[model samples]
Target: MRTIYDIEYLQEVTTEIQDWDYGLVQGMGVFSTSERYAHIELKVYTRDHYTDQIIWNVKEEYIPADLSDFRDEIEEVLTFFGNYLYALKGRREKKLVYEVIDGSFCPDTCMRSFVRATARALVNCFNKERFKPSPADLNRIRNSQANGLELLKSFLTHASQEEVVASLKNVSLTVDFKALFTENELFLINENLYNSIEILKKKEISQEAYFKKHKLITKYGDISQIGMAHLVLILNRKDLLPQVGVFQDEEIAYKFLSC
Candidate 1:
């Protein structure tokens, strides 16, 4: 009995794809196969140990006929990465981060991180539908003064995957990202200061009115909207201070503040 497509024939047929062209995989090892269209296209790896791997065997019919849409397609891929970066802002989990950037243990901000580059590369499958800034997104910095955090939002508003890559390709991305980031930082800082002052108004202590205003913006005082505000008030009001209040760890508070 003879088979319609002999399994042994794949060896010879694979050599044809291997000799002249290299697309699906780099070397020649069966990585995986797609049984989607009832036609089996085997994924193979080339001899190169690194940097040579084929994704899958896509048919010629599946290939895009128009080059015009290619730009948008590429943009979608970039936007996927951008969204990924957005979602992982507060996430410090090393394994969670590892799942994003592909073995990328980003030690830049927090502790050591690990992400796989494959996640970044496969991002082509996920993309932004369209570019639009949500009102809730713009309001983030309005409530907090984290500029680096704010710019991530604005980057979504004014850019898409294509827009970012195009700007970078043109060498204008740095200037644009910086300018936008600076504007957001400044605006957010101002808003934080305004809000911080208002938040303090509820602390109605009679001993300090004029002095409290001056102390807040002073060099000795803390300017942080949340953290430093509590510190400033603690030092200013002896009764409300951690040492006098029902502190969970009064000794720790006293030692930490040196008060």
Candidate 2:
């Protein structure tokens, strides 16, 4: 059976977009049709090795002249429908395929550039929102002093779908090293000390040789803002230092740690 998803008013479209692919399913499609009005089609199909059955085929059509204007509304509607379809996913009883196809006289030119881009953006948003952190991971994000929650929020909202999926999959790994140090111990290790020690370790230099090679900027115990900021930066890198907290921006990290 076929249906109409939803209709909306004109809004502008942006040019920059990435393709949408989730698991084994492709989320975007553009097709050639008779030169009349541009059409966007969304479909859900249940398939097995031998049989393919249509669950629902929903479509929305727009005038070519109006496509540019209604682009924003188009995005909203697409996202909404995408979410609806996402809710239907993960039914072990059936294997489903979800698709957004655009029909245009020049599918390559019209749908490929605009409607397809919108679909991709919607998919990206979904990929970002779909991730659910474990309870322990949530505690880490909460305890993070570097603004870890904000970094996670920004990553989900702004990053590409692939980036969101791949980078966040092992987000817990960023803090795995924390087990080796107490929170106080980690906080005390300033960037200067860390960097110097790292160089010495990498070069297999003795502590005496390392001290002789590099000039001391300040006494090791001095709590300089640069030293503190660097400490937070390293700890908050990718929010990897789970105990240190994560910041959405470096400037924020410097400000939060300096004070």
Candidate that would win on TM-score: 2
Q: What is the C-alpha RMSD of each candidate to the true structure, in Å?
A: 21.6, 19.8
* lDDT digits (tens) for residues 1-259 of candidate 1: 2221212323333334224232332211111112111111122222443322223233222211121232233233323433433343433221111111111111021110001112222322122121122354234312323343332222222212232223223323233222322344434434443343334334333434332343222222222222222432322432322422224354544443343
How many residue-pair clashes does candidate 1 contain? 19
Q: Across residues 125-164, which tens digit of lDDT does each residue of candidate 2 receive?
A: 3343322233643343233323433322222222222322
Residue ranges of candidate 2 with Cα displaced over 4 Å: 1-44, 48-95, 99-259
lDDT of 1: 0.27
Error of 2 at 212 (Å): 33
TM-score of 1: 0.19
